[model samples]
Target: MKDIITNIIFWVVGAIVLTVEFTFKFNDTLGWLLTTIGVILIGIGFIYKSKKPFKYLIEFFINFF
Candidate 1:
């Protein structure tokens, strides 16, 4: 239960990071770094057992475009 909440936080934060990267340009290395970290966080969020992660990803992509 705690882990679920924690992972959800991970997912949300990652989504935010990705969004920021796409919404605003940053220093080249900084943008790449944030993107890499954001992807890693999203993967970490998916490591737990739950459909919520997929739902979050779907919503993120849908809203992203």
Candidate 2:
């Protein structure tokens, strides 16, 4: 119950922040923080959901640089 309440609070705060962010000029700190979190979450999702995610990640880095 406590965890669920905490999660709801976090979601509400996140939504309010996003609304404020969109209403005003872009915020660099918020942008980077959200982007980094999004990227990491997506990476983790891909790794756990895909059968050959590591191979793709390695290939991407090798081709990137």
Candidate 3:
């Protein structure tokens, strides 16, 4: 149940980020911020089973940098 809820939240956040990205014209810094967040959420969703979302989140940070 907890995993399900976590995945749902991640999906919702990712969806919102994508919608905002498409619906508005943000400046480069804000755009990169949103994109980074969206990607982190997605990557976390993909690797949530091992309690390693933080690891995946850091991976996203590395990639974005």
Candidate 4:
């Protein structure tokens, strides 16, 4: 399913971005950039009606912010 694949991609990307942000102790600008992108991808996944993964991502995003 296209939706499944898309959500998976977004989920993976978001996870990677957040991981890099936390692991590197980089500048705030880079941190914010990654955070913003991760949030946007998760938000798009929600908009596109991704199911369980999206639900979990939404919960993570909520707690993340």
How displaced is residue 58 in candidate 3, in Å? 19
Report how far residue 17 has shifted in candidate 4, in Å.
Answer: 0.7
In order, candidate lDDTs are 0.85, 0.60, 0.78, 0.74
The ten-residue window of minimal lDDT in model 3 covers 42-51
Model 1 TM: 0.67
Best by lDDT: 1
Q: Predict model 2's lDDT versus the native.
A: 0.60
Q: Which candidate do you rate higher for TM-score, 2 or 3? A: 3
lDDT rank, highest first? 1, 3, 4, 2
Task: State the displacement of the C-alpha of residue 49, model 2, in Å, after optimal TM-score superposition.
Answer: 1.4
Top candidate when judged by TM-score against the true structure: 1
- Tens-digit lDDT track of model 2 for 1-65: 55445545554555665555566646688876765554554455435444587897898789989
lDDT of 2 at 4: 46
Q: What TM-score, to 2 decimals, does candidate 4 have?
A: 0.62
lDDT string, candidate 3, 1-65, tens digits: 88878887887898789679868958789988988888788666666774675777788789989
By TM-score: ranked, best first: 1, 3, 4, 2
Q: Candidate 1 on 1-65: residue-level lDDT in tens?
A: 88789889988999999999888967789999989989998888876666676786688679989
Q: Who is ahead in TM-score, 1 or 2?
A: 1
Total backbone clashes of candidate 1, pairs 3 or more residues apart or in separate chains: 0
